[model samples]
Target: MNFILFFIVACALTFSLFREILKRGSDSILLTVWKFFSYYTTLSNFLVLIWFAALAFLPSSEIGQFAQNANVAAAITFYILTVGIANYLIFGWPKLSVYERISDLSVHAVTPVITFVYWLVFSEKEALQYSLIGYWLIFPISYALYTVVHGKWSRFYPYEFTNVQVLGLKKVALNAIALSISLVIGAASFILLGKTVGRL
Candidate 1:
């Protein structure tokens, strides 16, 4: 099933990333970027991309989300895997550069933000709420600064956002805002969960 495939890949990626983090100390800019990225995004997304590409055959209802609940459950599992990786990324590795540390920590920023927004949009049918964009907001804003920080052209770009526009700053700004707001919601949700669990 698609769920098992995704979960397994996610587990492997998490383990590999953890081993690399322990070996490398998560200090290098490259490691920081990798850790930041690895924490929040599943390697399975890549697998999903390949699965879709090989779509000479379409999946039956069993392979992927058979219902909205299944989709939510899958997303939650992915988020748990991500956070489990983050526990090590933040506290396990050697103390990192300020940039490395914060960026590495931002792995916690993506899911709840995106999920809450998905709920609002899918259920409430709203058009592009800001809470949907959280850690996602970082890919563009950070990449732009990353380009300037490294003083080179980044392969990353504004187009990754679901809403890209024609050759202007407005598109960038809009995307940034949406992602930022979503990330905030995500952070809040995580903190709330931590508190709830800790208290119980």
Candidate 2:
């Protein structure tokens, strides 16, 4: 299942990225690809692909061992879930071709749900701890910082909330802090759920 999911997500991400690049009609395909990857949605789905691949093919390796950790799995689940929720709440659904829609839904909707279900059924919660949530914040915080710096250079913000040009640095910073708080809360909830499930 992990290996199969890896391919499914990889195809979805690749198709979406290719379509985006085509739509842009940029002379530099590499730059377009870099911009496409700047989106949180793309990054989160890419993380899922990497996680699934690690679990499927390299379970004995160091990275695979890290990927298999319950807290790590839960963090991935949360990040992907945020992708879907943020899309729905902030962007809603945009009109797209059928193929494009399939790619979008695969990465934003199906991937997150299935990832959570997989974690619920297979993850070991015995080692879950509140301290690990701080570690999980590293990826998101780093991404937020990267988005700000990248947007300043390119004048392109992937999401409205992170658009410093219009929203200003103060607003963007506030938005980031708000999101960080929300993630901390969500991470706690996941830990609670995992600990509860582990007991049963």
35-70: candidate 2 lDDT, tens digit per residue = 888988899999999999999999999999999988
TM-score of each: 0.30, 0.93
**Candidate 2: where are CA atoms >4 Å away?**
none
Per TM-score, the best of the predicted structures is 2
Residues forming the 10-long window of minimal summed lDDT in candidate 2: 18-27
lDDT top scorer? 2
Deviation (Å) of 194 in candidate 2: 1.6
Q: Model 1's lDDT to the true fold?
A: 0.41
List clashing residue pairs in candidate 1. Answer: 131-182, 133-178, 133-179, 134-179, 134-182, 134-183
| lDDT, candidate 1, 1-103, per-residue tens | 3344434444444544554565566387575445435323433234332332222233444433322332233234334444545457545876776655544
| Candidate 1 lowest-lDDT run of ten | 121-130
